[model samples]
Target chain A: QKEVEQDPGPLSVPEGAIVSLNCTYSNSAFQYFMWYRQYSRKGPELLMYTYSSGNKEDGRFTAQVDKSSKYISLFIRDSQPSDSATYLCASAANRGSTLGRLYFGRGTQLTVWP
Target chain B: NAGVTQTPKFRILKIGQSMTLQCTQDMNHNYMYWYRQDPGMGLKLIYYSVGAGITDKGEVPNGYNVSRSTTEDFPLRLELAAPSQTSVYFCASSYSMTLKSANEKLFFGSGTQLSVL
Candidate 1:
């Protein structure tokens, strides 16, 4: 199985709508979860990061992780056109062999229209 | 800070040709990585280096090689390119003060689009 799995969604939404992106991982060693945003023809940039289970919020974006279920999610509230980009979820283990390696899932493409 | 810069923004090569993708970072980060992004394949790590003269393979390392001769540059070379190797390549760097900071964020380069035909 893939270490990380995400729906490659070309999800379209109107401005001010709420956007939710999710991912699941099969690696039990993964302890750190992250969300990255990539614009067309650009590299991915870290948008949100969480250490373990629970939620972390920053402005209009929220990241939630559930270690028990091996699930992670990113929520964007009152989305705007500027928020239109591909969202990628990544996971990393903090232990011996897999220390700095991050596994990423297929990104979901989002378009927020005016 | 020119965080990370990749050269040859776009390139096309016939199968069996060779090329090098250049990446430079001004951040002086100790960790550098090369990844390839394909449609619906996310980003797969090709190679990574922790410091100058030290390199290691990541998930997808075949057909690619990398060198870290300085703290600022990490270059990836494809000696015999194949059609299956065509993809957008990205270079990233990060700094971690300690092992506990393994989750330190990564700074990425714009990208290099390469086509092998």
Candidate 2:
């Protein structure tokens, strides 16, 4: 099985709606969790990052990590059209090949309609 | 800082042709990585270097090679291009004070779109 799994969603939502993106992983060694935003033809940009399990808030985005369940999520409040993009969840194990290379999810494509 | 920069934003090659995807970072980060993103798939690591002259493979490394001769650059080379190798390539770099540091905040390049026909 893949180390990380996420629902590849083309989830469509109207402006001002709440959006939630999630991912689950099987690697217990993963110690760092992150969320990235990728627009078409662009590389994935780091959106949020957290260590261990907890919630980190930045602006309209919130990242939650549950080490016990190996699950992570990104929540966007009052979403806007400018927020439309693919959201990717990634994790890193301290002692892995590639020196902290992130294991990424398939990504959840979100569309915030105006 | 230009964080990370990749050359040849787009390229097309015939089968068995060879090419190199160049990556450079001004951050002077010790950790640099090369990844490929295929349609409907998550990014797969091709190669990574933690420091100059120290390179290693990631999840997907076949048909590809990499070199880290300097702290600022890590280049990925395809010896014999194949159609299956066509994908968007990304170069990323991160700084960790120690070798075992758990931090993995990555800064990526714009990307290089390559088509192997």
Candidate 3:
């Protein structure tokens, strides 16, 4: 089984709605979690990052990691049309400089309608 | 800075053809990686390197090889390309600092989309 699993969602939401994207993983060794946003024809950009199991907030984006349940989530508030993109969840272990060799999710394609 | 840069934005290859997907970074990061993103799938780690001349296999390393001859270059090679190797490949780099010490965020390149038939 894949270490990380996420729904390949083409989830659509109206502007101003709150959005929640999630991923579940089977690897208990993963300690670093991150969320990335990728627009069409563009590389994935870092959105949010969290270590261990906790919540980290930056502006309208919030990242939550639950090590106990092996789940991670990204919550977007006050979604806008520009926020429409593919959201990816990634995790990694403590492997020194290769620390960012992330295990990514299939990504959730989100379209924020205006 | 260009951050991470990859050459040959797109390519197509035959079953036995060989090619190199070039990646370079200007951030002076000590860690570099190569990942493949299949359609409707997450990025899979194919190979990685820590500093110059150090390389290791990742989750999906078969049919591919990588060399980090210099601090700035990490090139992936497809010696005998197979259909399964067709996918969008990405190169990423990050600093050597630990996450707890400082943010070891990743910076990625535009990506190289390859199709092997």
Candidate 4:
């Protein structure tokens, strides 16, 4: 199985709607979870990241992780057209042979329409 | 700051032809990586370097090779291009992976789109 799996969603929503992006991993050793935003033809930039499990909120974005289920999520509030982009979920191990390596998901394409 | 820069933004090569994708970073980061993104395949690591003169293979390293001759540059070379190698290549670097701060995140280049025909 792939280390990380995410829905390649071409998810479309109206402006002001709430958007939820999620990913699941098979490796329990993954301790750091991250979410990256990529615009068309542009490389990804870190949006937010959380260590271990729990919730982290930054402005209108919230990142949540559940180590028990190996699930991670990124929620966007009051989604705007500016928020339209591809969201990628990534995870990395804190220690071990894979310390500096990051496992990424296929990414979900989001479009917030007016 | 240029962060990370990749050369030959786009290229087309005939099968069996070889080429090199250039990547340079001004951040002077110790960690550098090359990844390829295919449709719905996410990003697969091709090679990575911890510092100058040191390199290691990642998930998919069959058709590609990399060298880190300096702290600022890491180049990926494809000895024999194949149609399967056609993908968007990205070069990234990070100050560290200690998870100490959000600033220690990977910064990616604009990407090099290569088509092997």
Best by lDDT: 4
- Superior candidate under DockQ, 2 versus 4: 4
Cα deviation in Å at residue A96, candidate 1? Answer: 4.4
**Cα lDDT over the full model 2:** 0.88
Top model number, TM-score: 4
- In CAPRI terms, model 1 is classed as medium
lDDT of candidate 3?
0.88
Q: Please list the residue runs of candidate 2 whose C-alpha ends up more than 4 Å from where it truly belongs after superposition.
A: A96-99, B97-104
Question: DockQ (Cα-based) per candidate?
Answer: 0.58, 0.50, 0.58, 0.64
How far does residue A63 in candidate 3 sit from its true spot (Å)? 1.0
Which ranking of candidates, highest TM-score first?
Answer: 4, 1, 3, 2
Ranking, DockQ, top scorer first: 4, 3, 1, 2
Weakest ten-residue segment in model 1 chain A by summed lDDT: A92-101
lDDT of 4 by residue, A1-114 (tens): 999999998999999999999999999989889999999898999999898899999999999999999999999999999999999999988874342578999999999999
Better of 1 and 2 by DockQ: 1
Query: Per-residue CA lDDT of candidate 3, range B35-56, in tens?
Result: 9999999998899888899998
- Candidate 3 has a DockQ of 0.58
Clashing pairs in 3: none
> CA lDDT of A66 in candidate 2?
91
Indicate the residue-level lDDT of A78 in model 4.
98
